[model samples]
Target: MPALPRPATGPGSRYTARAATTRTRPTPARAKPDIVALARRLTARDLWLTALIHEHRVLTAQQITRLAFTSTRSAQRRLRTLHHYGVLDSFRPLTVSGSAPEHYTLGPAGAQLLAAQAARDMTDTLWRPTSTGRIAYSPWLGHDTGVNELLTHLAAHTRHHPHTRLPLWLSENSCARRWGDIIRPDAYAHWTETTPHGERLLPFFLEYDTGSQTLARVEAKLPGYAAFTTATGTAPALLIHTRTASRELALRRRLTDPARDLGLRLATASLDQTTDTPHARWWMPLEPTAGRLTLTGLAVRWHPLTPATGLEATDADTPLTLPVPPLPPAPHTAP
Candidate 1:
């Protein structure tokens, strides 16, 4: 017999090679649900129940009802709804000694739903004010100005309490008040206790001076805040100068002088320009300095202010002396 014909090395081999390559490729992961849609379905009660099941694999309907403070009927209804939604899977034994308790466990879909809900909640908590779709109405506060930058930076830095709580007192129009409006500071802050006369009900008063016109406009409106505070018993006044050499210093003196007078003293930070570090971009008290300076008062703790720096030159003075490689010749086309 003729030597078995040698297999042809051509298109047949190429086809087999391509088929193998295609089989080796990985399938992409499934995407999670739409955040808005998921959030809409997540009731407070649902969240509570999901958390309960996540902590314990097998929970009785009665146990869930007791923990959630619902009647047996309500609990059963919720359980049935969750079971229908594929949030939970249930099983009932064929033989029961007494009244059979229905046991429930989170299904794969339920676990995924809970995880997605947790991620969305974290994101919502982080960027609260701006995430809520409210615009910054203080026209005097410019876009990307020092205060706005500070607010954005604080939003990131103060994700937890103390620093985080300060934002609750500020609003879009927080700084806006007619000439005589009272400055109502947050009475809840322990810092307000340091003020003389327990006048925590009064406003802290803030004023921004853009120019002579702005100053005159604010001066006319200041009394409204004072009258409002007196009537409501909430302190609500502060005047912040947008531009002025002694602005911060003057404010510090006014705040701290009374402490010294009362003999129940507090230390104050000096606003000396020469002592100003680059981190002094805003008037943040140096972190936990000695003595009574340790108290942060109503001020929010921000990240250490970092100045923008320029990139260093890679090749200084001398030219790049290494010879460049020659280019490949252009391909010739068949005539």
Candidate 2:
């Protein structure tokens, strides 16, 4: 087993922008709203979305809808209301073809509420008035949103499928807090499917690529994951989602030897191949001539992979907290 490498945290995953021009909305200038009043009026989904934005840093309006709402209009209307109330802040990045959807981040009131819920100060949430501006102009905005979209789609899929649940979805920052020393995956997730036979769990580290990095740079990250598996004594599958079919193919060719040599269970998928219902058979194993497999199918293909640990309730009390619980609190029913 290889020794764990020194903590080599890279820049946040780059969501490369294609636009030469960007239009950023001015930061909100209103005084901080009453946290008590805001907290009392927030809906179940509102609080959940707030915490999610704080956890993930940013999510586009469409991504939010997939995770929380039934319709685009309703999601937009409610998100606008949240923005007006200072519970959420949003900005749109301009693109060559058209304007991008609104990207949301935690606002002052939302930060206060989340901190109060966690029994901490607002600073503990790491939010500043300029947080939205920072995220809006981030070079990696596209990459972050891309990574988020994949999980949001999966979450949406589970909403209509009674037999499945996405029990865990941790953003890159959360993964860094736990495993930054050895590896920095774009995101981490735990999924489960309950069938007649039994419950199957698929816990994975997501590497979302935008084709900005060279194939060698991409394959270079494998050793870190290898060391992480050795250090933790757990081997979570590494699922790499590429931006194009050609890139995916080239990457699989480049990574096959290194991944196999490290005894890593890895899979590849392309954005072009994944539909809204992402659980379909889109993922191809790194091995040659292997047919594409569904998300859960990959789990079964690599049986006896160690279940994700250190995410127990007791682990959340540290200075670095656990990721927000995957599912939102149940909607409040009228008494």
Candidate 3:
């Protein structure tokens, strides 16, 4: 007669008394938060975060925390706020172990904000970020981020250690402006490490290698470095960071080739050496006679790098500044 309707066996159907189950509830991701509402809530601190992302071009979540925030938890909340309001954009690379770190780049709203701060037309400059920001996804992102990792490590170390300071941290682009024709070190920095004896300035040209280039290609850059040192009369140490132990060994051999007879002092180390506690990292001098040198001890290991000029010579190529110890933190008062 009227056949009974088929039993609904699907999970949502009323086929059984049982209900679907999950171990735990997961937080849902925000696809796109209310842009206008979030825009109205932007704070001065948020603007500073945008400026930082703009200046660095690319920074990991951890790096951002180091740059601005006191804790990762707070950094996450703030980054989410900026991302929702379109002032910051982020991407994570695929990884084998654990989750990937979210790397941030300045977004359209950040560009507009910067333009407005400078009293410039947003139409032209605001759109510039799209052209500039896509670099976070470029193939070289790994290498670029690796280079920046070294910088962030040094900056963080400087913050904690009283005896050390990173006074001048210049990006590769800034180095290009300063020494473009001669040689552009991936970066240029003045490291001042104090001891009971005295503070020493360890200024060096950083060459962060990702092991993508052949040893031959690496050697090709040596002559430029040698020439730059000779011209400046300030022997800025040429510091090379390789991706692996084998890569470091290969690079060290290239640095030792007497046939090249490079006048510059070369130091080689693997990425593992500098990832954490950068101050503890060792840079093995190309000279077999010299042992691996710690970050603070570079002055003793590479004495030649220090300008020979007398203290009266203010015209020194790169003037070293006195160490500035971190100021004591303010006392917390009861709320």
TM per candidate? 0.28, 0.88, 0.74
At residue 194, candidate 3 shows an lDDT of 83
Against the reference, the lDDT scores of all candidates come to 0.33, 0.77, 0.61
Worst 10 residues of 1 by lDDT: 11-20
lDDT of 1 by residue, 1-335 (tens): 11112112210110111110111111221233243454666566665455445433334564455444326887787777666555665543222133334555554346666556454433322222121112122222121122222222232232222222222223222222111244422111112212343322211332332232332343344445435544654332232433333434443444443322332112222213212121223333312342322223322222111111111223421111111111111231111
True-vs-predicted CA distance for residue 215, candidate 2, Å: 1.4
Name the best candidate (by lDDT).
2
Global Cα lDDT for candidate 1: 0.33
RMSD, model 2, all Cα superposed? Answer: 5.9
In model 1, the runs with Cα more than 4 Å from the true position are: 1-147, 150-167, 173-205, 237-241, 246-335
Better of 1 and 3 by lDDT: 3
Cα RMSD, model 3:
14.3
TM-score of 1: 0.28
Order candidates by TM-score, high to low.
2, 3, 1
lDDT of 3 at 192: 82
lDDT of 3 by residue, 1-335 (tens): 11122212210111221111101112321233333454567775676556555555677888767755667898888787676556776666544334446777766667667666655666633345354435633556666666777777777777667678876666676566467888877877778888887888878888877665677777889988877767767777778887667678777776687324876677778865555655574788777576777866777766645631222323322211211112212332111
